[model samples]
Structure formats: structure tokens, C-alpha cells
Target: MFDDTFCLNVRFLLNTQFKMIELPDNIAALQSYKPGKAVEDIFEGKNFDRTAILSSNENNLGTSPKAVAAIQEAATNSYLYPDPSGMKLRQKLAAKHNTTIDKIIIGNGSDGILSNIFKAFFRPGDELVSSAGSFVAVNVMTKLNNIPYKQAPLTKEYAFDLEAILDLVGPRTKAVYLCNPNNPTGAMISNRALKAFIEKIPEHILIIVDEAYAEFAASLSSEFPDATQIELPNVITLRTFSKAFGLAGVRLGYGVGSQFIVDTLMKVKLTFNPSIIAQAAGGAALDDAAFMQETIEMNKKGLAYYYKNFSQMQLNYVPSFGNFVMLDMSTEERAMYVFNQLLNRGVFVRPLAFFQLPHCLRITVGLPEECQLLVEKMAEVMTLEKN
Candidate 1:
């Protein structure tokens, strides 16, 4: 009996030991991406009656009425599984872009599509080259997947250094990511510069142009290149309903690329990645051209308000093509101090330390009232700092 009991105990110990698992070194070493703080979380216990969430560059004008109706209609059919292929949404997206459905790929969001691209095209040691201080997702995903990443510094005016980025592209570089109307700093590359840069890139390396803020950029500048209009074999343009469509909560986005690249990305994408409701909402949003125009107009007005105020105050800010502007505080400490003060005043703006622009704070263009409040709070904060 004693021998049998000891043998069972030994087996249990061996099984437990075998079950212990270690994550890959790359994943184990990764620092997770931090999204903008939620309004509720930030304002908890604060006595402020009003809050302007200007941290995330969301469409404050709200979701399209048509999208809302579509989402409501789709709710009743939630019992059925979503179409894994996302055919209908792809059809709508293709029609909108004047392309075939075969060249379109949809995912949970642009971020998910980006992940699939990284997984499908890159190997463990392959490199991704992108602008320094651009979107954080590319950096996060590369580190998480054990892929090497190289960053080319932004120009002195906070625009993409296209020549520097081209210099960084080497033989093992699998992809180049260009976040047009770049985040944190809403600076953009003109059509001429972008076209030249694309032409100079090697055919083997894929160019992934992330145009999350493309609509706003296009409205602000006639020179902004619409990647969809560019017929490069190596280029993939990513767009999302999260911005202008105001469907961020719906989590729908797509990639337009060559048939070959789309096919490969489909293999890595999660089945039924975007739900039926998200698909329906995206289709409806595309049709709601009036809502999109209204959102753009509101953003333009808000940006104009900010420009006037910043100019009057003599505070330096990037002339933004996107819906957000970055204010330079002259020092990281000052930026942090202003961020905290703004938070206390019930205003939320993004601090840029994480993006390595330590002395800057990114403020999304909010509603007219919110924009006024943001400017007022900034003025107050600067005054307090001066004292």
C-alpha cells in the first residue's frame, strides 16, 4: 500500500512539472500598449460636474444615425454567428474605394488588421521600419512578436523624415509603416513626398499606410494623398470606422491591398473577427456621407478655434492636418504639470512622454464648447505655472 501511494504521488509531481509553461522571451519581455485613460476612470471621485474627454481623437459629433439604425436592426440577429469571410462589408468597402472585393480585407479594427499583416508577412527576426514617434501599435506588435523594428526620426517640423526612413530600410526589412497625419503630432506628408518615397522603396518590402485620420487630413489639406487612389503593387492602405464614422465602439476597419497580400492576411485573421453588428454598422456608415461631412466640418471649426486661441496666447503648437494638435511645453516636467492641471480642471489631453515627445501634449479637437473650455483651462494652467 505504501509503495503504491508513493508511486502515485511521484506521478502527480511529474505531471504538475510538465504542465508548467514559460512564455516566449519576446512576449515575456514586452510592455503592453497603454491606451488613453477612460473619462470615468480619470474623473472618479472628482467633484467636477463637466468633463471633456479630448485625449482620444474620437468623433465628438457622435455616430451616424444610419449606423445606429443598422446596429439596432442587427442586434436581433445576434443569435446567429457572424459571417467569417465578412463578404458583404467587403463588397461595400470595395464599392466605396472603386476596387474589387477580392482586394479588401476587414478585421476587428485597423489594429487587428495590422497584427495580421505583421504575422502573415514577417518572420521572427524580420524588421519593420517606421517613423519615430508615430503610432504605438506597430512598435508594440513588433516587440510582442519578436520582430525587429527600426525608427527614423521625425523632421524638425514634426513631419515624417521620408529620406531618413528610406535609409533605414535594409535587406531584412519586411514592411514599412507610414501613419499619415501622424498621431501625437498631426503633421502629414504631402502627396509628392509620399509618392516619391513609395517609388524609392524596394519592391520586396511592403508599405503599410495607416490612414486612421485620413478623412480629416484630406479636408484640411488638398495635398494629402489618398492611399486608396495610389495604385502601387506594394502598398496596403488601412482605414477604420473608428474615426469619422464615430463607430469606434463597433470596432470595424479594413485593409486595401493586392489580392495576394489580402489572401495571406485572411489566413492569419481571426474567424468572425468583426461581429455582424459591426459589419452592418460599417456598411451603413459608408452610406451616411452627410454625417461624415458634418463630423469633418465640426472638426475643422474646433481646430480653427484652437489655432486662434493658441496664437493669441503665444503658445507654440503644431499646425495640425488631423483632428488633434500637439502643444509644446518646452520641457517634459512642464508638460506633465499642465496635464495634471488640466485633469483637475475636468479636461483630458494626451501627454506625449510615452511617444518620446516628452515636452508635448496632444489635444483632440472636441465640440465647440469643449474646445473653448480646453483653451480656458490651458490659459489658467499656464497662469498658475507662471506664479
Candidate 2:
């Protein structure tokens, strides 16, 4: 018995030693981003021929024809290194935003720009302020840097409670992150409220406004906030091509701010961070104004359909200004159960327990057909639970 136990102990120690690779304290301790399951991972051996992924808020219209053609034309040049400055793309985007190219710095995605923003301004023990129920990336970034961030509670309506946010700010607060037309709940902070909040905040604190879903918010103009023209010294707005521009696979995004802030971030930004193809695709995507218009119109229709269905089913949902909506499940567990069942039916949506919103799920607006399939599958799943 002693011999057998000693042999087992030796094998266990050998395995542990092999697997215990050393890593940076922060990198080793970090809780990584939990990505949504890919279609292949969910249906590897199953007979599913078609899967509808509404989990990630991506453009369903596919890539713009002009962008696709540009990519094909540029394919031959892939062997050579791309322009480090990405000047042409920057010029075009600057023109689109009514700002000089110097005011924009492109990155892998809005998330990349966000990380740069954090790194440029944040350090250990610095405090960051954000809404309690927000995108997971905010928490991930804060924890990774060992920065202190307080989650200001949203109002009963799930909108940004500007007063609560201001109340939490202190001397250590280096930055505040906000998802204008916030994720999961889709509640937005209005321009008037933002202006008021800005007035109250200390000038030293930087405000990072992530507008990944801004095109959709613009479509809901009357209900959504006017984010285009809030000139503040410390405010930075991040936008991405992954959503309305249909360039998720290409992963391109940029941030718009005063030249001072832009230039400061550029100092720390990875040289040639945005890939050649991504920059080219982003520039081409912006040029396709007609495609963008169609996408806006379709998203409006899909959101309307979602609201009508929610009302018909007597389900409680947070009114959305973005391309997604949050439905209140009886419990977070129930929401998760429904999420799994939706997966079984080849429909994917997001669960928001990470944001402390356990009773809700974030469903992205898809094409009409995809939305219909999702609603039908949801109905079936809920009915089965009732039984």
C-alpha cells in the first residue's frame, strides 16, 4: 500500500510542477474575459446546419460591398508592411467626425482604445468611477490595473444616476467610464444630464464615453442622448466599426477627443497597433453612407418589433436606446436556464449576471428573420418551463 501511494504522489507532484508556470502577478491573478460560446463549440457533433448568433451585437447585414471590394483589391499588397500612420484612413474618419485626423487614434477595437485610455491615465491605487450595471470590460480593466473603482447605483429606471455618480467622486478618482446608451440595460445618459454631470465633476477627472452602439442610439434620436457635441477638456469618446459598420472580424475602432488628449494617448499607444487591413476596411466602411443608412433603418425596425413582442407577452423589459434590450427574468437562474435552452435551439443571447443584473438577459437586435427565430425559441423555452 505504501509503495502504491508513493508512486501516485510522485505522479501528482510531477504534473503540478509541469503545469505551474510562472506569470506576472497581475496577469496570473486576472479574471479573463468570458467570451460567448462560438457556434462550433456549441454544435460540434450536432446536426445543426444553421445557427443564429444574437449574443454579440454585430451587424447582420454582413460587410458592405464597397468594403469587401476594397479588401479584395488590397489583398495583393498584404505581403508588404502597411502604412504605420494609417494616414488615409485617419483623414477620412477625421472628415466624417468633423475633426482633424490629429484628434483620432485608431486601435484594434474600441476596447483596445479603452485599454490605452486606462493605461495613459491610470496607475495602481487610482480610483475609477462607473455605473454598477455596465459592460464587463470596465471591471476587467480596473481589476487588471489594481485600480479602485466604485459602482454607482443606477436609478430605478436603470438610467445613469448623475447625482449618485457625482457623489461618489473623490480626490483619487482619475477617470469615469460610461457606456452611453449602456449595455445590457440599454439605459442612456442624456446630453443635458451629461452636461450637468460634467459641470459637477472635478476638471482633473477624465471621462471615457464608449459609444459602440451610438449609431443605433442616433436612430432613436428623440429618446436617446445627443452625444455629438459635448466639448469638455477631459472627455474622450470611443467608437468602433464592429457594430453598425459590420467589421467585427476586422476589429477596428477609434477614439475622438481634443488634440491634447489624443496626442497624450498616442505617446503610450503601441506603434502601428491598428492593422493595415482593419484601417483600410474601416475607412471604406465609413465611405459607404448608403449601407450605413440601411443598417440604421433595419435596426430601428428590429427594435420596434422587439418592443411589440415584449408588450404582447407582458414581459418587463428596459427600453433600449442601443441595438440590444434587457428582459427581466423571474430570477437570474431562470434567465440563465432560458439562455441555455435558447442555445439548444441554435439561438444565442447574452446573460448579464456579471454586471449584478442577475434577472436580466441582453439580446442583440438581429435581422428580422433572426429576431423572429429568437422570439419563437424564447416562447417555446418559457412555455416548457411553465409546464
Candidate 3:
């Protein structure tokens, strides 16, 4: 015969003690990664019937019909567990890249693959060097893992400063994370520059080239290097089906590296990381070459439209190789003002304050009509600012 009131009091005391427990120093100090605002949340109470979501750099043309069909087909077999090894997807990806299947490792997303790498290789106090104002995920991951990191400032043109990064590397440096066609700024390092930089890096250091936006950049410029094609054992390329493939919602990405590195990551990767549906969608997306081409073409038109309008307005912006452009508002206050104003008018763009580029806003290249709407809204917002 247990006393109910006494049990309740004891449980309450235990919960209070648990709440007071201290978190690890690194975990307590970590700042969360903030994604772009959702369209539904922004337009929840507003009377606007339509919204142009240019915040997240997603393909606005929607997922490929082939991928949708594959997903629908895969839904029937949800009862069984996913292929834990992801052999089929890995084989297809390896074939496409002209590499052995052992070189490919599938993940929930590129983020998941990165986590596996960090866990497998990095130790507390090991140095991880990266470009400041580049992809913020590397920084977040390093901090969460308690790995010491150093960031070199970007060049005047907002490109990765290879020289500064090289200088920062030392005996303790374990990894170097480089985001090609970098996020927020959308600047890229030339093939020659990248090769020269990689040559200077010490053999002990791992070179992580995150090419999530590689398809978009490659379409725009022949100078962009395909890291997987390079014969360097130390270099690992991270890619995703999220961007040009129009399969972001599927959460499928992969890493291409040497057999040794891939084997190491496999040990750390969770069993069945990517679901069955995600694998099917990714395979179908890769097969739909026509849809991928169409998405790239649409992005090109959107970029041209944005460039023409931004130049006409005499606004400063980075010449982007990726599917997004960063517009410099010249001041943090003005950027914030414009962001809120655009939201009020049913438009969403990513303000770069969290990424440490407070004076800039990153807008994704959506469909043609969406780009036109964005330009129109910007004109109205600027006019309102002046008056």
C-alpha cells in the first residue's frame, strides 16, 4: 500500500533537482542555427492571399514529378525498415560520379554527414579552421562538439580568403571547412585558386569542401571545381539533393571521399539515417535530368532579372554564382527595416544578422513571377523609405 501523496511529492522533488542540473560548458555556450522564416507563420494573420518565399534557398518550381511518383510508390513499403546501408542509392551516386561505391556515404542531409565526420575525427581542443561569414553550420557543429575553431575573414569581394586560412593552420589543425559558392554572400573561389590553396594545406589536415550548391554554380561558371573529380585523399566533398534536384523535403545528402574516410564515417553514422522514401526520391530526382535542367534555367532567368533591377536601382550586391544573391542594404538598421517591410507586404527574405553580415539580406532566386514580384516589392519598399 503506497501513499499516493507521498509519491507525488517525491517525484516533484526529483524533477526540481533534475531541472537544476548543470549542462556542459560547451553545450551551454552554443548558439542555435536559425533558419529562414516560414511563409505560413509570416502570413498567418495577414490579409495577403499570396506570398513570395525567397528566404530559404529552395527550388520554387516544386519537387520533380518523377521524384513525387517515386515517393508515392515507396510509401507502400513503409512497414519495412529502410536499407540501413543505403547500398542502392550509394551505387547509383558512385556510378554517376565515376567512383567506387565505397567512396559514397549517405546521410539524413549534408548536416548529418558532417556530424558523423566531426564525431569520428575531431577531439576537444583540436583546431578547425574555416572562413568567417561562410556557412554557419560548421561553426555551430564545432562549438557543439567542443572542438576549438578559428575563422579567417572573407576577402573584400566577400570570397573565401585562402591565404588567410592557410596562415591560420598549424600543427594542431585537424580540419578545414570550405563552403564553395558560399552561403549568404554567394561568392566562389576559382578552380585555380582552390587547387593552389589545397596544395598548401598540410597532409594531416582534412579538407571539407561543402558543395551543397555546386549544381547551381557549375551551370553558371566552368571555373568551379568538382571536388570529387580531384584525386586528393584528404579532400571530402559534401553534396545534397536539396537544391537543384528539388528534393529538399526528402532530406537526402551524401559525402564523397576516400575509402578510409568513408569507412570511418560509416562507424559513426546512425543505422538507417535516411528513410526508404528519401532514398527513392533521391534516386528518381537524379534520373530526371530534364527537370534538373529546367530548374537551372529558371534560376538563371531569376538571377538575370534580379541583377538588372538591382543595378538600375543603384544598389550594391554580390555577383552570385549560386541560386541566391546577397543585397547590401549599407546599414544594419536599413536591412532590418527592409526585411520587416517586405514581410508586411507578403514577401520573405533572409536577413544576415545571425550570420554576422548585418548589412545584407540573402534572397533566393525563385520562379520568374516570384522574382518579378520581389523586384516590385523592393521598389515600393525603397520608395516608402525615401518618403
Instruction: Output the number of the TM-score-best candidate.
Output: 3
Which portions of model 2 show Cα errors greater than 4 Å? 1-25, 32-37, 48-50, 226-228
Return whichever of 1 and 2 wins on TM-score: 1
Q: What's the residue-level lDDT of 334 in candidate 1?
A: 85
Query: In model 1, which residue pairs have backbone atoms overlapping below 3 Å?
Result: none
- lDDT (CA) per prediction: 0.90, 0.83, 0.90
Q: Count residue pairs with overlapping backbones in model 2.
A: 0
Candidate 1 local lDDT, residue 201: 94
Give lDDT tens digits, candidate 2, residues 267-297: 8878877877887788789889999998998
Prediction RMSDs, each to the true structure: 3.6, 4.5, 2.4
Tell me how candidate 1 scores on lDDT.
0.90
Off by over 4 Å in 1: 1-20, 32-37
The residue-level lDDT of candidate 3 at 280 comes to 94
Model 3 misses residue 317 by how many Å?
Answer: 0.8
lDDT of 3: 0.90
Name the weakest run of 10 consecutive residues (lDDT summed) in model 1: 31-40
Stronger candidate by TM-score (1 vs 3): 3
**Per-residue alpha-carbon lDDT of candidate 1 for residues 1-387, written as tens digits (9 for 90 to 100):** 669888779889878554458888888788665797566488887888778899889998888999999999999999989999999999988998999998999999999999888889887678999888888777788887788889999999998999999999998899999999899799998999999999999888999999999999999999999898777678899998899889999899999988888999999888878999999999999999999999999999999999999988888999998889999889999889999999899999999876889999999998888898999998998788778
